[model samples]
Target: MHILMVSHFFESHLGGIERVAGHLSRQMIAQGAELTWAASAQDRAPVDIPALALPCVNPTEKLTGLPMPIPGPGGMAALWRAVGRCDAVVVHDALYVTSILALVMARMRGRRVVLIQHIAGIPFASSVMRWVMGLANAMVTRPMLWAADRLVFISDTVRRDLIGDPARRDYALLFNGVDGEVFTHIGPAAQRLPEGKRRVLFVGRFVEKKGLSILRAAAAMRPDISFLLAGAGPIRPASWGLANVHDLGPQKPAQLAALYRSADCLLLPSVGEGYPLVIQEAMACGLPVICGAPTDRADPEAGQFLRGVPVDLSDPDGSAARVVAMLDAPCLTLPERAQMAAWAAGRYSWAAMARAIMGLMAG
Candidate 1:
């Protein structure tokens, strides 16, 4: 089957949705399916796959020492032309004007369109921006839902969020998968820590939704453990005053692999998520993950794989205690780690996700 994959950003933007799109497209091509990518013009070149670039409607502009909004022109004609020749169109992220245009064009052409709802609900944005997004969802995204042949959500929580209307059918719960082969190799825990120090890794954006403040508070609570914060965001500082907390900035996949191998455990105190890829990556590397339970939060699918595991985020004291326990406990043996890696490999494979999408297209 011929497929067209559409996303807002590509080529190492390093977001979960971007990574999923890249992984899906590559695996689909390997499985003997023709795939093409459509993204913004400002995107970096040599995507290592066939792709089409369109001018970025929203350009970042500085005005009076403040950043200006980037407006994207809806490329309906171009998107229609691209989807016309393909059997299915898979939209990775559905917030942008380009994606909306593609959704409209796909409905017009009677082609199968699959919308991947990456984020369940908006959080912590400006009131104006939140209202604008809400309005857009009501006007563009709601109608597009009616046009979709099927809806693909990374978690059952997301599926529940989209299942308000009984008439809306054809939805599936597919959790995000990781590349088990890359993280299966287990590295020995180094004994070079200063006296009695533990290494903890936190990977994600430095945003409100990610609960960076809670992480910082937890770090402050645990003075014996050393924290390494990866990834870039507007809210992150070049450095922090906390001696135990080290801001390593953003690291590539290779560097991250080394970090995961050396680290004792992964800490994710996020307030919102849609099947976070980092959790699976950590699990594949044989690292135990301590995350916030989805109770009171919007996304329930996060706790699906975390069954029977402790997921408490009630307060900083409780959160830090869990992290410390996981770090201080006996590490998983290599064989045991391999078993966890195998589970991740089998559960979240890109091939399986692609097959699920193919099933949607077939219907």
Candidate 2:
């Protein structure tokens, strides 16, 4: 089987969806399917995989931090041809131009299109922006979702929010997988900081929605606590110039696993997120996690291992104080960490995610 995957950016961007796409591509190949990945030329694709680096201009991403890659005429023509040859098309989300165009082209070519919707909505700080996003979802996203041959939601929260009635829509609730081999509990995790100082880790894009501002406030309130920020984006953590904040930049899985093992806890106070891959990776590495209440409860079973808190965009300082309180609390014990790792790895797998998607493609 030949499959074409369309995403806004590549795995090198350090976003969760792109990473999931890369994992699925490898798993599909291992399962005897020919996979061709196409994304914006903004970042590099997987080194050894077959890919079409579509020429695109990302002005929106530069200005607003939202990735919207618009392929040039030549790239669009190439994508049209690729759709004609592929047996099935798998799109990451319904929001991006690449995904929308892929849906249209796949439909025109009569190819089976599986829409893997990652997020339902983003609760932006701006009410105007929130309204705009809601309009986009209603006008564009829902239509594209309905037009696809099959729908797969990575988060049950997204599925429930978007398709309220489970029986009303034919969809699959598929969770993104984690690589347990790389992110596993070693023995007991030691404190990387000096004896009394605590290390708090935040892994993901440095964008506003990822709660960089709230984290900044939290770091200010508690100068004694160390804040290690991993992954890069328009919002530069180093520029914050806080003595307690350390920017580690983008990291690979192995490097991230190391950070998780040493860190006291993972902090992600972002809104409108599905269960982020970083949270799962942190849990797999036996690290405690503190994220938005909605996302922490994304998976009921996994929620047991997470610390959920309400995120108030209007009151970032108040939100920061709450995070500081969580930090001050006692850390997880070795046995509890081991239990968390066992549960996460046992439930999610890249191979299983691939198998389910392949089954949909086969149908």
Candidate 3:
């Protein structure tokens, strides 16, 4: 099968959906599918597979910290050609300009399109921005979702909230998978915690939606606890100048797995998310996770091991207080940690996720 996969950025972009696409692309290729990844030229695609780099200008991300890349005229034309040759088209999400365009072009060309919706709505700090996102979802996202031949929702919260009735809608709920080989429980559980302070790790882009400011507030309240931050973005945690805050910048998978094994807990305070790959990775490595209330409940099975706290963008201190309370709660036992790791390894499988997506594409 000649499959054309489209995303806003390549896996190197350091976001959830991009990473999922990268894994799916490799798995599909391993299963003997001819996959062509198409995305913004801002990041390079995997050299092993064929890729079409669409030249784009990312003014939205630069100005607002929302990565919305608009492909140039020439790049759009190139995508048009790729869609014509491909047997099927797979789009990551419907919100992106690239995704919306791909949906329209694929439909016009009579190619099968499968949309994998990753998130429902991001609760932005700015009221105007929130309103704008809502309008975009109603005007653009919903329409593309209905237009696609098959729809796959990664989060139960998103599917339930967006579609309302799964009994009537034709959609599949597939949770993302984690690489057990890379992320597994390592070393003694006691050795995981440092002697002096408890370490809380945050992995993902430093965006307002990711709740870095709230984390910073939490860090300020707890001077003794060390906050190890992984990933970089417009919002610089290093600039916050907190004594306990250590910004490690973006990390590779192996390095991230090491962090997961070393840290006392994993923290992701963002809202409007699907079940994040980081949460799965942390669990696979036997690290406990604390995230926003909505996402902690993204998946019921995963939620059992996660701790969720209400996030109020307006009241950073209050949000931070709740995070601190979760942190202060008793740590999971060594056996409990092992149990968490085993649960993740047994539940999430990259091969399974790839097979399901390919089946949908085939239909």
Query: Native-vs-model 1 lDDT?
Result: 0.67
How does each model score on TM-score? Answer: 0.80, 0.96, 0.97
Off by over 4 Å in 3: 165-168, 187-195
Lowest summed lDDT over 10 consecutive residues: which window, candidate 1? 61-70
How far residue 276's Cα lies from its native spot in candidate 1, in Å, is 0.6
lDDT of 3 by residue, 171-285 (tens): 9989899987889997433234344688999999888888988999999999899899999889988788898898998988888999999899999988888888999999999
* Per-residue error (Å), model 2, residue 140: 1.0
Clashes of each: 5, 0, 1
In candidate 2, the residue pairs with backbone N, CA or C atoms under 3 Å apart (3 or more residues apart, or in different chains) clash, namely none
Task: Note the Cα lDDT for every prediction shown.
Answer: 0.67, 0.89, 0.89
Which regions in candidate 1 have their CA more than 4 angstroms from the true location?
A: 57-77, 125-142, 164-168, 185-196, 295-339
TM-score of 1: 0.80
Candidate 3: minimum summed lDDT over ten consecutive residues — where? 187-196
Tens-digit lDDT track for model 1 on 193-279?
564577888887665556566677777777788887888766653454788887878777767767777776777766446667887
TM-score of model 3 (CA atoms): 0.97
